[model samples]
Target: MTVELRVLPPLLVSLAVTVVLAACTRVPPPPPPESREGFPERGARLIQQYGCGGCHTVPRVPRAEGLVGPPLTRFGARSYIAGELPNNAENLRRWIQDPQSVEPGTAMPDLGVSETDARDIAAYLFTLE
Candidate 1:
């Protein structure tokens, strides 16, 4: 005995292909660049990638209303770093490079930000004024 398989109609096949092609043709929107001084576009990307908003409140980044850590809105204007070290670029760099070194047992961990990224993040944080 011989068996025959039914084939889908050509019109249905073409319509399915058209629907798939249209779905695949979608384009994603480009990221918005940070226009603030010191906080370059790259730094903003890094901040989002590093999950900074998971713990701290970062301006402009949506869903960054976390309160696990201190609000960074006034980090630049703060008089002291970690409530002990003086606030400055150098000190901020040190803190970002290794938070545990500056304050052992602190809940904050160093996210391994490079010197350049640290400066940019700090610049953005400072602009929170």
Candidate 2:
């Protein structure tokens, strides 16, 4: 075989590797529009209404541009909440409903989020992943 033919196999392998890597690192798309009263959508609305954006930078939430607290750009992927509690749906809900209970000196105050609203808010936060 000629030199070009000898290099074809390696070139093809490299191209395949690049394609696989690209696919692996691909970013997830945005969630679809609110569907039949989904908690995530409801939670998003509640977040805005409750002025959550006044403190934290929630991704994709309208007017969620506050800089008082930590930015929630990829909150679902975080390992901990409030830099203490493990990052989980239950923990998120608990923290949302009552921050002072979790961390006495925490800047995040108890916003009086009801259990249902807390659940919905957590659901929406997890969607950021």
Candidate 3:
């Protein structure tokens, strides 16, 4: 009733280890394309008003070094939203406006962001690069 892994050679064991380590490592996604839809400056102010820094570690904004959520250092260069939705102006805006609609039970609460505010916030996020 004893199981033996001797059937697997040393080289196979090394290969398996290497594969597992590689899988555990995370590779940053390709940056999203640039666009000229929302206003970045306005978005920055809105970020402060929305208090997004309380959870996410956002750059530039004072006292925004929160560790509750992921750091938004190079958010503009990311390829996905909430690690699910495609990174685009519209999707970003939607997520900012109503995070609950995008992901149920997500820690990112819906802050009742107005459409205009969402657009501005998205614009500011895209400037993080």
Candidate 4:
């Protein structure tokens, strides 16, 4: 019993230290998929086609000045979507597909965006950084 108690304390301490150290270390997320490459250009075209400029002020997009919705100038650096969901590729795509679903009664209408188009749009949005 005495031997076990001494050994257990040291083992527990070592385990706790290991866990703390591991938690303190961070591993960066992997790079975006290769298939998403060359999508920004297409996404830019889609944005223009969708008339997104009618609502938000998008950088590099001509006549993308409006006061209805929030500006998407630094959209890529934003941390949240509609200030609700995390600003990731998947969430962005979902929001693009169905803004009402993500946030009911939102002014941003669902443009019936297809999955491929959503992905491309996301790629372009992330490029704003």
> Candidate 1, residue 125: CA error in Å?
1.1
lDDT of each: 0.70, 0.82, 0.84, 0.83
- What's the lDDT of the predicted structure labeled candidate 1? 0.70
Q: Pick the candidate with the highest lDDT.
A: 3
lDDT of 3 at 38: 76
| 2 against 3, candidate with superior lDDT | 3
Counting clashing residue pairs in each candidate, in order, gives 0, 0, 0, 0
Candidate 4 on 1-129: residue-level lDDT in tens?
A: 999999999999999999999999887544432324339888888888899989988888778887799988778777778988877888888899999989999999889889999899888888886
Candidate no. 1 TM-score: 0.64
Give the per-residue Cα lDDT of candidate 1 at 97.
79
Task: Assess every candidate by TM-score.
Answer: 0.64, 0.69, 0.74, 0.71
Off by over 4 Å in 2: 1-38
Alpha-carbon error at 90 in model 4, in Å?
Answer: 0.3
Predicted candidate 3 versus true structure: per-residue lDDT over 1-129, tens digit per residue: 123456557768899999999999988665584547878888888888888889988898877877888999999888989988988898998888888889998899889999988888888888888
- Candidate number with the higher lDDT (1 or 4): 4
Q: Rank the candidates by lDDT, best first.
A: 3, 4, 2, 1
**Model 1, span 1-129: residue lDDT tens:** 122223446667889999999999957533222223346456556677778889888877666777988877756566666876766667766787789999998888888888888877766665554
CA error at residue 60 for candidate 3, angstroms: 0.8
In Å, residue 98's CA in model 2 sits off its true spot by 0.6
Candidate that scores best on TM-score: 3
